[model samples]
Target: MTIKASDLLKYDITPFLFGVLYSRIMPKPTDDSNPKHFYVYTAFRTSKAVLKTAFSLSKYASRLVQQYNSLSGYPNWEIHKSSDNAIDLRLYIQNDLNIDAAQFYNLVYKKLRSSTWLNTATINEDKKYFLRGYMESRGSVDTSLKLFAQDYFYNNRFELKRVQLLTDDIGLPISYANFNPRNMQPQFVSGENKRNAQFRINLFYYAKEIGFINEYKALIFEKAYKPRARIARDGIIYFQISVPNLNSHVAFIKYINFFTNNIYDKVLTPEKVGILRKQIGFNTSQELGQPYRNKSIVDLFDELSEDKCALCGTSQTFKKKANGRQSFEIHHMIPFHNGQEFDNIANFVKLCPTCHRSLKRGSASKDDQIRSIITILGRHPEVFEYTSSALGIEELPKLAEEIWSLLG
Candidate 1:
């Protein structure tokens, strides 16, 4: 509701500082029938860009959490006493008391103006020791990033399969992905397991955060991503996130051009190179994390009732004329050839078993699936054609570059 912080001294801040401040949210009301059931959604300061447009009641709040960390110790912002990470907060609030939107905006703006640091004397001295100690106390890098990723993937947990099929070796293909998750329960890292329990915990928190707001979860990748490496016990773990279906070959060509054009002109960090390569290469499962059927994903779709037939677009209520059986099956809308091109959530759908088998067997064609999607989208036929063309063009160069690198 209300937030205040010291200053936006970027030099003294750490990512962990942001996490700490983000952990707090306005408490949920116990009474379901209460007239004022307003909610506060929490996210990274960077995320303010996205959520600001969606939540309309007008009260908004934010704070900058600063921390310094080192091998010796860190600081804790929660206690507010001062440990290692120097915690300075900037708080802002938007209130909707009159149930009037205009008044709420004024209240929120006024709250932002009032936020200031409580401990001005301590942070001004030295940020390094204070910030370091705070981060150390906050938690491990694994813990922090897991929380961040969990929150990011919270809305469409089902999309986790897409992330896995693209990145993990053990992930299911689009067609087989609709099988009951309860059947595959043994294969996953259960909530009971302690190995990387932080990832699971963060995932649970993420699911709740998205579920609470009743928002549709979707994954959007940046067009270009810089790569970075983390020191593993052996070599290094190079990772990058990018738009999934860019022309791989074209990407490589453009990247080569960009590098030849700009590498020498700027300080090309290992991260930048890493970003270029995340989309390319034979990413071994050993270097990357394993894939498992994410229950979160299943829960997401279950909540949305999105498991309609991928081929015939039939609902579960549909029954077979001959057998009188209910319908519902997972279908890989994209052919196998397109798997490498685009088999993410946008391309997968639930279909009746009869349609699924028919599509696979070629008794019925994917044209049905395409037509259904087109009808649902309600756009010009050329919209699909040109979109596919653009998608193919974008990835060709990147794919070519990858091939050349492999051959060379």
Candidate 2:
């Protein structure tokens, strides 16, 4: 049956309809000569469920085109897998219901890039669907919930202010962080020297208000929010090394004077002394000296390796926690949760926090799980041998699959 534009308008789903269209729509060559021939297309690299929701929401826009242009069609949207295996949901819009393709393309698509449009007054009260659509297209969940804007979008202070205002109104106050081009690779910098803007959302308010419309994002959100095991005291203790004569109060002052170029009398206030103590090895109570202890297998591995993440090869020297210790997480290639037998050193892999989070079971995508297994096995082939011996799986692919299943 041909759905009329008027019938679709009666439902008042324009906020969401336009939101998806605005965020995901691709650029097409302009044909100023043919207004009636105006058509719009948008695609998403997302799951089938997200596409289905978009497909349902797009029907309204399709009906608008059908009724206005006097066209008849059962399904106006197309869903297919792209070459890279990502699902693509494409919508073709012609003519207008309340707003036309050109208006949407200009007011939304163009303005989103060149100017600000996401304000409380413009988006109206029912902003959840609109935010969901935008997030589904450009948002990501990791250590933090964030929405990415186009390069230099936040360079305009007015636009940044508007974004802040809008998010504040929704009760999900966001913090903006600019990605400086100097810190990025030269190849990544554009001619305008602009970098992408990131808006970090308040997770607590996001959970209460706008949740994810994409199933994959929802799963990742759950994992990102999941409580993690506290860093073991033994793990922290392993980094502690005793300094010679640091325990002697007189020697401590002498060492401090040497480092401070003998300006200790003038500059070393009690507060400065306390801070320096903590920076060295002193506990909060001003306790001095660390007892020598034998290093564990994990510590040995860390020392023997390049002091970098095994997966991404990022140097741990630069990635430090607030207390001034290097950040690293020990990931089990064959998780011990499957069996305590896999808890040996052969199964262990050092990962940066980001890579570790990406590899979490159940929450991680199948592709990530498989890729990690491949990367780990490539680095330490002994892991495969150990797993084969333990699980009785002979073939590499099959063994990897077994490990993947065990992960879940």
Please give each candidate's TM-score: 0.27, 0.33
Tens-digit lDDT string for candidate 1 (1-408)? 222221322123332333222222232242332213222222222222234344322222111122122211232222222222222232232222323322332333233223233123333212222222222223222222232232211112222222221112211122211111111122222334212111111222222211111111111011012223212221112233221221222222222222222231334344543442343231322111223323332222323334465445567757657656564654333343543433232333455677556554335444553444444223322223222332432243342232222220
**What value does the lDDT take at residue 236 in candidate 2?**
14
Error of 1 at 93 (Å): 4.5
Question: What C-alpha lDDT does candidate 1 achieve relative to the native structure?
Answer: 0.28
- Cα error, candidate 2, residue 397 (Å): 73
Show how many residue pairs clash in every candidate, following the order shown.
Answer: 61, 0
Worst 10 residues of 1 by lDDT: 214-223
**Count of clashing pairs, candidate 2:** 0
Which regions of candidate 1 deviate over 4 angstroms? 1-308, 311-331, 334-341, 344-346, 350-371, 374-408
* Candidate 2 lDDT by residue in tens digits, 1-408: 323333433333344454454444332234343333233233333333244443343333333333213211224544423433243444444434444443444454333332223444443434665555544445545332222232222222123223322343332322222121121222223334323433333333343345444444454344444422212231110111121232232222222212222111223445544443443334432222332123343553444334567778786545465656577777777777776545555566778888888787777888777777777766755456556646767787777777888783
